[model samples]
Target: MKDRATVVCVRDNRILLVARERSRWALPGGRICRDETPNEAALRELSEETTLAPIELTYLFQFTGFNTLHHVFFADVAHHARVQPSNEIAKCRWFVPVKIATLSASIPTREIVELFFRYIRTLESDNVHRISQQAERVSL
Candidate 1:
């Protein structure tokens, strides 16, 4: 099985996506080199494909595809960051999570975004639950 690193770069509630000349849109990432760590590959791939360096990368989770193990990372980039598409990437664009379903992107791209959205919702709910629990304890 192959190992790959994918970066989900976010800015202003939008996600960064890249496309090759005739390929479907996808997250900025590539297969890990023999001597490179997953994190290193993700950073390199993001920069190489989009020319947008990540402020910082946070490992969110991982998933196994048919032939690849994907290591996913999240980065919050500045909205002003320049995105110069390289040879490997013909174009770059940003999309809100809700609008992603309308794009002709790769399956993994859609799945990743949906999963990320669910994760954020879960976190929000958990925080709310925690706060409510604390309030109840205080009242009791």
Candidate 2:
């Protein structure tokens, strides 16, 4: 399977997606170069495709597709960040998670997105639980 460095850029609860002419909208990313780590490739591909630099980039998890192993990364960018489609990308847009099901997107893109949101919910739940535990301890 080919290894791809995929970036999921989020702002205002929306995800950034890019597309080439006649291609389905997909996350901004590309194949990982032999000379670079997945982290480096993720950043490079994001910049190359969207011309939007993220304020923060974090390694998420690996997602295995039919023929691609996606090294997924999460990126947070300013809400006002302007995206210019560059390189081979013909267009760029942000879409809400709920809207993803209606769009023409790659299977990997859709799966990765759904998985990422679940991961986020898990993190949020953990944080809330920790905070509640701390509060109970303080009360006791």
Identify the candidate with maximal TM-score: 2
Candidate 1 per-residue lDDT over residues 48-119, each given as its tens digit:
998888788899889777788889999777668888898589999988888888888888889988888888
Instruction: Please write out the lDDT profile of model 2 over residues 1-140, one tens digit for every residue.
Output: 99999999887888999999999999999999988999999999999999988888999999999999999999887788899999999999989998988999999999999999999999999999999999999999
Off by over 4 Å in 2: none
Which residue pairs of candidate 2 clash?
none
Q: Estimate the TM-score of every prediction.
A: 0.90, 0.97
- The per-residue C-alpha lDDT of model 2 at residue 125 equals 100
Candidate 1: which stretches are off by over 4 Å? 138-140
TM-score result, candidate 2: 0.97
User: How well does candidate 2 match the true structure, expressed as C-alpha RMSD?
Assistant: 0.7
Clashes of each: 0, 0
